[model samples]
Target: MKLYKTYEDLPKIKLPKGQEVSISDSTLRDGAQMPGIVLKVDHKVKIYEYLHNIGIEKLETFVYNDRDRNAISMMLDRGYEFPEVTGWARAATSDIDLVLDIGAIEETGILMSVSDVHIFDKMGLPSREAAEEKYLDALQYAVDHGLRTRAHIEDMTRADNTNFVYPMIKKILEIDPKCTIRLCDTIGFGIPFVDVEEPFGIPEMVRHVKEELKAVNIETHCHDDFGLAVANSIAGYWHGANWSNVTFLGIGERAGNAELEKLLLFLERRIEGFDKYDLKSLFEFAKFMEREIGIRIPRNKSIVGNNVFAHESGIHTAGVIKNPFTYEPYPPEVVGGKRAFLIGDSSGIEVLRFKVEDTLHDLLDVKISVEKNDPRLRAIQADIQNLYNNEKRVSCISDEEIQAYVEKYFLFEPIVEKSMGRKTL
Candidate 1:
């Protein structure tokens, strides 16, 4: 059966220039927040080191407000190395000071809500003007304290008033020349094919925002509510985003964030001069997380999942064996995966013979006593082969086909006479 669409024919995307592959692993902060998944200080440091060894740029290890002082202190004391550890925080004077006090201040990025709804309803501020004033105060404070800052616009996708949001962004850029504002779809509400007129849809607003804030950089942090986190993040890059926040395996709150592996895989194919990282270690990292950390790698999950290169049907297996490009966007080996031919009911005689005579020759060589003329022995072998095939769901071949091969090759008589006087057929 045909999938909804082929990966190649889906759409042709154009990635921007100078879009380097940088990763921000949130395993300690966001990934640990998964229900029933928690880590002690040592466990946190271990994962942090693992991520750093594998070449992740930023590691969102913990929050650094007054609320998480002890955890922050312990991590610092443990001499954790690898990733440039950063803390997530609200754009508040006290919160920012708390982060700086705890030594989480180097190159820190603070999230501030630029959406009018947050300003009016959440902050209970009289107007957008007051919120803008507070943001400027926070930005100035961050810059003065020698903290290279990045602003996060919370709930950016659903902001009712881009008229106000865009201006607020411009003001933040003006206050600090080198500041980078992160466009956050906090509620996982952005889409890929958004209309230019849609309210708070990132695709429509990204170009305008980047153009206005040309002096300052732009980043994107999207959610996967509509299964468009990757698309929206790429859209942001397409529209000139300078940075993007990604987590390993897309693990985060709610539907999770854009997966780092998926994002890198996209860039590798779409953007030239972007494949410099050690991608093989990424698959090892994914497996380590799945086997040790207990996070199940979903079958259809992108990049590092188990089924990314598994083929069962005769047609798909044959096509893949002939030319991987017929079924895969890139060779599985590109990301530390290999093609796997799963023997199941749909396997043709050729497929079965390949598995039985070639792959499973050792298992088949186990001697079994049977009369030379006994169709029963051949039937049993065919039945057992069909059982494994059926259980694995052979989608390419029929039972009759496998049975024909078995009857012809497996039912042949022995060359010498046996003690029972049965001659070779």
Candidate 2:
């Protein structure tokens, strides 16, 4: 193994130039809205430092109240600078003032609901023109206040970009070319695949905004209603999205937001020069979130999942025993996770040998050598199989069972003369 002094000295392992996307963490805001997930003011300080040191470019904080405002202030006073902190707010000057007065955030994200459902059904506005005017008024107020703004078009996937969204973009650009607009998939209504049109397909919508809508500095914000948040985010990235809005573990309202870990893992693989993201801290972050938020991580969650690196199937264990890459896309250590193997009813003989030779040799300081057709190995395997099949056992045999069996069998001296045609050991 070797270390590189500079990024130039390292191997090129990114998607490509000009396709790099920035990350804006939404854990403290939208993620906090998760039903049972809650974080106090003190937690924000550590979380902020954690995100900053890991090179996360931005963190979304809440400017709606004093608790969040004071927390943001304390976090800033800690002098962590990498993650330029931003606050989530409505598209209004008062909210922006509330955040800016704390002297913490230089930028803020404002919600601009674009879907007809929000425009008519929710806001009770006369028409799209009325709703557009309402958001424009708020945008104008934000722009006049000299605060950098991220106009999040909420429920974007459920709206007609041509009729409703395009006009808003034109108005926004006229208001100020510096304002960054976020395309929000409010209900996880986005589809990742191509050969599709607007009303939820992200690829076509992303391209449309860039080419036709002439929107500048587009951001991608997706939900996990259909379990396509990560996929939708990647699609937006490939289609010229400049930013990916994410949460720590995809924890948010309803389904959730795109997972920061999943997005970074994919970006690390496909996008060149996208290596600045601290991948190793991800596992710790996941664990910390689980402990602090009181939500257990699902065993099969991607990248940071408990069982993402756990192998148990006989065939999978055998392949992984030879090479981890045979059964995994990336090494468990890459994410600071340990590779684990579980022996069960589907266990094979090679797995048994691997378990004993690889694990027991170091612990017991005893070597148990057995051939492929060894009668002792067959007897042990028969017992294991009988436990599951013949004896009606529901669970797999434990390591203690195998260990006791092996210890007893090894104690028996091999000496045969009359039982077989040849002497056997």
* Runs in model 2 lying further than 4 Å from the true structure: 1-17, 366-370, 373-379, 390-406, 411-425
Judged by lDDT against the true structure, how good is candidate 2? 0.79
> What is candidate 2's TM-score against the reference?
0.87
Report the lDDT tens digits of candidate 2 across residue range 45-156.
7778778867898888887777887888888887866788887777566776786686657787888888988988987778988778878888777777776788899999
Model 1 scores worst on lDDT over the 10 consecutive residues at 354-363
Clashing pairs in 1: 344-389, 344-394, 345-389, 345-394, 346-394, 346-396, 346-397
**Would you estimate the TM-scores of all the predictions?**
0.77, 0.87
Report the number of clashing residue pairs per model. Answer: 7, 6
For candidate 2, which ten residues in a row score worst on lDDT?
8-17
What is the C-alpha local distance difference test score of each model?
0.67, 0.79
- Give the C-alpha lDDT of model 1: 0.67
Q: Write the per-residue lDDT of candidate 1 for residues 1-425, one digit (tens) a residue.
A: 54534445444455654454355666776667766555666556556556655566676655653334555565566564546777666668887776677665376677677677788888898987888788778888888888877787788777754577777777778777787677888777787565756455676667777675573577778878778888888888876676778777887788888877887777776565565455666677788777767778887776787778977666877677666777887777778887666556554433444443432234366544444344544454466566675575435344454445444555553334357675799
